[model samples]
Target: MDEAARLGLVERYIAAYNRFDVDGMLALLAPGIRFENHAGGQLTAQADGIDGFRQLAEHAAALFREREQRVIARRSEAGRVVVEIAYRGVLAADIADGPKAGSVLEMTGRSEFAFADGKIGLIVDRS
Candidate 1:
């Protein structure tokens, strides 16, 4: 994809994620897309393909009462898009396996996206 299209894809993807629109997000991804999340320099989650990504997104949506991610900066080059992001969310409840409920979480992170056939083929998030 060209630079404009690549950037548009990333922006739309982030918008979908902020809205918790799993289908919308999936529509921008290629088949068998790979997604991974890293925190503190350790891999926290991994998903493969549409189904896997949907499951992960659902779990995330369930955990937060509301979530939003804003793009701080973005760069597209060589079939990859790198984005700096600011995230904020409110917890829905005390998570049995995670953070306490009613807590607000805010953080900054960066994500890298690799494109194939004009769709996202891989995503790596770091925070």
Candidate 2:
């Protein structure tokens, strides 16, 4: 994808995440997309298709009560887009399971997204 298209996809993806629009976010991902959440202790999610993505999204919803993505910076080099995102949210009560109950946490992270065929292929997040 061109730089504009790549950046647009990234922006849209972030917007959907901020809105907690799982379906919308999934729409922007490739069938076999893979995302790595470094801050989440290096958790990796692979969406082989929309169904897989939906499942992941559902899990995400269960884990986070609220999620906000603040763009710190963005740049495109070659065919990859790197985004600096500040994340803040509360962990979902059910997902936290214990110590995190009623706890709100804030974190900052940088993610590098590589787009292919107008869909996200790889997302490496370093928080």
**Top lDDT hit:** 1
How close is every model to the real structure, measured as TM-score? 0.95, 0.84
Residue-by-residue lDDT tens digits, candidate 1, 1-127: 6889888998999999998898999999999899999999999999999899999988888888889999999987677899999999999979778789889999999999998888999999999
Candidate 2, 1-127: lDDT as tens digits: 6788889999999999889999899889887777766655665554555677688778877777787989999998778999888888888764434547456768788989987677987777787
How big is the positional error of residue 14 in model 1, measured in Å on the Cα after superposition? 0.6
Q: What do the candidate models score in CA lDDT, each in turn? A: 0.92, 0.80
Alpha-carbon RMSD, candidate 2: 2.3
Instruction: Name model 1 segments beyond 4 Å from true.
Output: none
- The per-prediction tally of clashing pairs is 2, 0
Error of 1 at 62 (Å): 0.8
